[model samples]
Target: MAETSEARASASAPGGDAGGEDDKHDERMLECNICLDTARDAVVSMCGHLFCWPCLHQWLETRPSRQVCPVCKAAISRDKVIPLYGRGNTKQEDPRNKVPPRPAGQRTEPENTSGFPGFGFGEGFHMSFGIGAFPFGVFTSTFNFGDPRPSAAPRGTAQYDEEQFLSKIFLWVAILFVLWLIFA
Candidate 1:
C-alpha cells in the first residue's frame, strides 16, 4: 500500500511532462461525441456526455421520437442538458438564429411581505359611465377617456408603422363624419 501511494504521487507530480500530457487528454475528453471535434456551445447530458449544442439539436430533430445521448443512449432533451462555460470562451454569438437559444440561468428575488398600510379597498375600485345618445357616444368613442390605454408600439418596428397608418386613416374618417353631421 505504501509503495502504491508513492508511485501514484510520483506519476502526478506537478512539474512532470506526464502532467502536461494528462491536460491534453482531458481536453480531448471534452470533444463532441457526434462530431469527434472540440465542442462549441458545449452542453452536458444528465448521463455525463458532452456535445456541441448545434450537433445535438440536429440529432434530436432527426430522431424526434427517440431523444437520447449519442454516446450513452441516455434520455436527453434541450432542457435536460447543462451548458458548460469555460474561461477561454469570449465571443458572444447570437444564439437566436435557426436554432433554439441556450437557456438563460434563472434568478429569483425574495418576496416582499409588507402590506400597503395607507391604501384602502376603495382606492383600488374605479368605475365610470357615460350616458348619451348616438352622436355623443360616437364623439366619446373617438377619444378614450377612462382607464388609460396601452402606449403605442416602440419606434422603427412594423407594428408601430401599421399603428401610425391606421390612426391617420381613423382621423380622416372621424373628420368626414363630423363634417357630414354639421352639413346635414
Candidate 2:
C-alpha cells in the first residue's frame, strides 16, 4: 500500500515526468502558426492564433487589403492583436528592430484646452462685394468691419520691401488715371 501511494505522489508532483510533458505542450502552444516554429516576439490574435511578430508582419504585408488569421480565417489586424510577455522573457532583442514592430496598446485620454472650447465663427464675421471688369478691377476699394486685417511684415524683410515697391507702383498708377479722367 505504501509503495503504491509513493508512486502516485511522485507521478503527480510538479517536478515529475508528467510536468515535463506539460511544459512541452505549453511550448507547442506558443509556436507560430505561420512558421510552425517556437514564437519569438509572440503576439496572439483576437481569434486566439499565435504568431511571431515578423511572421505576422510579413503575412499582413502579403495581403494588406485582406488581413485574416492564418489558422482560423478570422478578422485580425496589427492593432487588434495583443503581445504576449512570458514570465521568463528577458529584454534581449528589441521588437522595433524587426521590419514592422508589434503594435502598441491603444490609449485614450480626455482633452484639455487652454481657452474657450466652442467654435469662434460667430465673433468675427465680415463680407465684401465687388463688381468690375478683369484688368481694371484692380482699382476697386476693399472694405472691412469686424474682421481684423493681418499686420504688415516687419521692415527690412523681403516681403516688406516687395509690399512697399508694389504699393508705390499702384499709387502712381491711380494718380495717373485720376489725372487722365480730369484732362480727357
Candidate 3:
C-alpha cells in the first residue's frame, strides 16, 4: 500500500512524467533501425541515419540497385557508410551476429620512372651495332625486324665473359674465311 502510494506520488511530481518519457526516448534512439534492438557494429550512412552493419548489409544485398537508408530513404552503400566505434567495445558479445568485415579502400602502385622494361643504359638517344661482319651481320642483327634488342649484360657476370669469348671466336672465323677466298 505504502509503495504504491509513493510510486504514484513520484509519477505525479513536477519533474516526474517528462523526465521518465525523455529517458525512454533516448534509450529507444540507440536501437537499430532494422532489428529494433541496441545496435551492434553500428554504422552511419551519408544521410545521417544509424544502423547495424549486418542489417544494412542485408538491406543493400536485397535491393542492390536501390540501396537507401531505412529511416530517411536517402542513398546508402557499404562503401559510403562510416563505421561507428565505441571505446572498450572492441569484442563482440554475440558470435552469431558477426559480419564479413567492411570493404577496404582502393590502392595503386606508383608509376615506373625508368624507361620501358628491358630498354637499358637509362634513358637517352640509344644506338646499337650488329654482330659478325658487315653485310652478313647487318642482316643477322640490324635488320632483325620484329626481334627484341638484347640489353648489354653487366660486366664480370658469366654472360658478359661468355659473350666476349664468342665474339673473339667469330672475329677469327671471319678473318680465316676472307683469307681463304683471296688465296682461292
Q: Rate the local accuracy (lDDT) of all candidates.
A: 0.70, 0.68, 0.67
User: Candidate 2 — which residues are off by over 4 angstroms?
Assistant: 1-20, 92-97, 101-184
lDDT of 3 by residue, 57-111 (tens): 8888789778778888888777788777778677744322377654565799898
Q: How many residue pairs clash in each candidate?
A: 0, 0, 0
Question: Compared with the true structure, what per-residue lDDT tens digits does model 2 show for residues 32-123?
Answer: 99897888888888888888988988998789789889998998877888777777878655442556564565888878755654354222
Q: What TM-score would every model get versus the actual structure?
A: 0.41, 0.41, 0.42
Candidate 2: residue 179 lDDT (0-100): 83
- TM-score pick, better of 2 and 3: 3
Residue 23 error, candidate 3, Å: 1.2
| lDDT, model 2 | 0.68
lDDT tens digits, residue span 1-184, model 1? 4565456667767776786557657867988899877888888889999888889889988887799889888888877888776887675543223386545657999898666553332222222333589677656655542335455456797766765576566568778988998999
Ranking by lDDT: 1, 2, 3
**How large an RMSD does model 2 have?**
13.9
Flag regions of model 3 displaced more than 4 Å.
1-15, 91-98, 101-184
Which sequence of candidate numbers ranks them by TM-score, best first? Answer: 3, 2, 1
Clashing pairs in 3: none
Q: What shift in Å separates residue 157 of candidate 1 from its native position after superposition?
A: 54
lDDT of 1 at 84: 77
Top model number, lDDT: 1
